[model samples]
Target: MILCVLVFVLSSTTLSQQHLSHPINFCSMASTCIHDGRGVCASSPDGCSRRSFLDQCDMYEYNCDYGTQFMTKVSNPCTDGQPDFLC
Candidate 1:
C-alpha cells in the first residue's frame, strides 16, 4: 500500500511539472488573418509622405514594431502614384 501511494504521488508530481514546463501558446493557436491580395498604401504628412506595404497586415505589423502612429491608409495603392518609399 505504501509503495503504491509513493508511486502515485511521484507520478502526479511529474505530471504537474511537465504541465508547468510546457505551457500552451495561445498566440500560436489563435486564428491567423488571411491575406486579401490587396496592398496597403499609407501616408503621413509629418513623417513619411507616402509608403507602400504588401498588405494591411504588413502595414499594421510595421506600425506596431516601429511604434509609429501617424500612418493613415490611402484609398489607392502606392503604385497609383509615386510613393516616397516602397516595401
Candidate 2:
C-alpha cells in the first residue's frame, strides 16, 4: 500500500511539472484575446475575472499581473480533464 501511494505521488508530481514546464503564457493569450483553442477570454484589463475560463486541455487558471504585463496560473492543471465539452 505504501509503495503504491509513493508511486502515485511521484507520477503526479512528474505530470504536473510537464504542464508547468512551459508555463502557459496567459499574457500573450490575453493580448490576442484568445485561449488554449477552446478557452474563452474572460480576462479583464486588471486581471482575470471570477468567471474566467479554464485552460482547455490542462484546466489551469489564467492569472494575470496587470502591472508587470505578465500572467500565471492560480493552481496546477487539473490532472483529470474537466468541463467534458472541451475534452
Candidate 3:
C-alpha cells in the first residue's frame, strides 16, 4: 500500500509537470482572427488598453509587422464576444 501511494504521487507529479511545461497558447484558440492578416491572437499586454482583460486574446496580440498591437483594428470583421481593440 505504501509503495502504491508513492507511485501514485510520483505519477501525478510527473503529469502535472508535463502540463506546466506546455503552457496553453490562447492565440491558437482565437475564435476569430483580428487586426487584418498581420496579427495573431498571442499574449500581449502593452498593445491593449482594456484594464480588466483576463485572457491573452481578451486584450492583445502581437502583430508580426507592427510589434505589439491591439487584437483588432478598424475594418476587422470581429464582432461581440470576440477579441477586439474594445475587448
How many clashes does the backbone of model 2 have? 0
CA lDDT, every model vs. true structure: 0.58, 0.42, 0.42
Model 3 Cα lDDT, one tens digit per residue, 1-87: 999999999889877653312343435534453433432233234433422333434443333333433433332333345443454
- Backbone clashes for every candidate come to 0, 0, 0
Tens digits of per-residue lDDT for model 2 on 1-87? 999999999889878753443555645545655345543333233443223345432223234443222233333322332432332
Better of 1 and 3 by lDDT: 1
Deviation (Å) of 46 in candidate 2:
29
Candidate 3, residue 63: Cα displacement in angstroms equals 8.6
- Looking at model 3, the pairs that clash are none
Compute the lDDT for candidate 2. 0.42
Better of 1 and 2 by lDDT: 1
